[model samples]
Target: MEWHQPPAALVRTMNVVLRGVLPSPLGRGVGEFMLLAFTGRRTGQRYRVPVTAHRVAGDLCALTPAGWRLNFRGGADVDVTLAGRTTPMRGVLVEDRAEVARIYLDRMTELGMRRAARMIGLKFPLGRLPALDEVAELARREHFGVVRLSVRT
Candidate 1:
């Protein structure tokens, strides 16, 4: 499917959410999640995509499909807003595929398969989690991207 480019205004709104409202409510429901604002390098438009957040080692990280979409995989930087603070995060793009796998496994389990799967954008009514190894493989190859945002204290 062709990628959808979010308008400039939407990007601004997302910036407000990620950099302004996500940190304090760190582990809340995904709905409370403000979309991780990303931009299309070629189109220069903004896209607001809601993503699960994790504050690890004092920095916040955002995850996306490895090979599933364009708005993120094709983008270079990510913007996260939390608690009224906005920060333009440069993309580090996890280079270690294994690390990606491990991280995804942790995230999925943290969210809970039957409960948080839907929130994370996974649709599996069967309520079964793919084998951990299988999930890792998909995470490694399936258009995934990770952008780490630094918290401005």
Candidate 2:
């Protein structure tokens, strides 16, 4: 898929809005959105991006089509702010397409067919989720990455 970069102004606006809202109760009610804080691998500067996160078997999972996930390629620690609370977590970049597919499929299944359909811009039969193999094939074609985070209690 061709990547289209958003305008810098739009990105600036989103960063401002997310920074202001993410720490509020309103942001917590806005579904699985979370603020991911990680250090840039090259610059050693902190960066925060808003991502949709899922709780899978006691771990936080995020699927991204962006390059920001590459920051964790060196197994760096991160901070995730969800529901107005921040926690330290260790992040792993799952490069195996099959494993990424499995986790992505599970998250889509938990989101249910209708919502998942809207998310991927596909139409699906009611109550039916895509098969794991199908997801794997799509992931391979689309180059999706999975970031699995374990919260340090």
lDDT of each: 0.55, 0.75
Over 31-91, each residue of candidate 1 has an lDDT whose tens digit, in order, gives 3454456676668877655555665446566666633234444236666654434467654
Candidate maximizing TM-score = 2
Q: In model 1, what lDDT does residue 50 have?
A: 53
TM-score of 2: 0.78
Candidate 1 structure lDDT? 0.55
User: For model 2, where is the 10-residue window of minimal lDDT?
Assistant: 118-127
Q: Which ten residues in a row have the lowest lDDT in candidate 1?
A: 66-75
Report the C-alpha lDDT of model 2 over 20-99, residue by residue, as the tens digit.
67777777775567888889898998988887667777777777777888887857788888888788998889877878
Off by over 4 Å in 1: 1-31, 37-49, 56-58, 66-78, 123-128
RMSD of each: 7.2, 3.9
lDDT of 2 at 141: 71
Clashing pairs in 2: none
